[model samples]
Target: MNLFINKCSKLHETQFNLETIHSLYLTREKIYGLNKYIENNIG
Candidate 1:
């Protein structure tokens, strides 16, 4: 039982880390797009 619980906890931690990374990646892409749009419009 303890071993199962430990495995589940590890999985949850991994999922949380993945979600954080995914969100950061999305934010970076959004920022890059916005910068490109501004540059095109301004320049």
Candidate 2:
């Protein structure tokens, strides 16, 4: 039972990490798009 619980926790941690990475990637893309828009307008 303990081993099963540990495995489940590990899986949860991996899922959390993946979600965090995805969010960071999305945030980076948004920042890049915003910068491009500003540059185009300014230039």
Candidate 3:
């Protein structure tokens, strides 16, 4: 987790801004959470 954040920090500085990366991360986390919820409740 820390290592991934560190790598993303580098990309945030060079390729994309922090805001963009953070928004994307949030969207991905939300989808992942939803998948887990469905799996636990239905699957």
Candidate 4:
């Protein structure tokens, strides 16, 4: 039972990491897009 719980916790941690990474990727993309828009407007 303890081993099963440990495995479950590990799986949950991996899922959390994926979510964090995904959000960071999305934020970076948004920043890059905004920068491009600003450059276009200024130039």
Q: Per-residue lDDT of 1-43 in model 4, one digit per residue for the tens?
A: 9999999999999999999999999999999999999999985
Error of 4 at 28 (Å): 0.1
* Clashes per candidate (backbone, < 3 Å): 0, 0, 0, 0
lDDT by residue (1-43, candidate 1, tens digit) is 9999999999999999999999999999999999999999996
What lDDT tens digits, residue by residue, belong to model 3 across residues 8-34? 889878766767888999999999999
List per-candidate RMSD values in Å: 0.6, 0.6, 11.0, 0.7
TM-score, candidate number 1? 0.94
Number of the candidate with higher lDDT, 1 or 4 = 1
Q: Model 2, range 1-43, lDDT digits (tens) per residue?
A: 9999999999999999999999999999999999999999995
Please give the lDDT score at residue 4 for candidate 2.
Answer: 100
lDDT of 1 at 4: 100
Please list all clashing residue pairs in model 1, or write none if there are none. none
CA error at residue 37 for candidate 3, angstroms:
0.1
- Ranked by TM-score, the better of candidates 2 and 3 is 2
Poorly placed runs, candidate 1 (over 4 Å):
none
In TM-score terms, candidate 4 sits at 0.95
Question: Which 10-residue window in model 4 sums to the lowest lDDT?
Answer: 34-43
Q: Score every model by TM-score.
A: 0.94, 0.95, 0.59, 0.95
* Native-to-model Cα distance after best TM-score fit, residue 11 in candidate 1, in Å: 0.2
lDDT of each: 0.99, 0.98, 0.91, 0.98
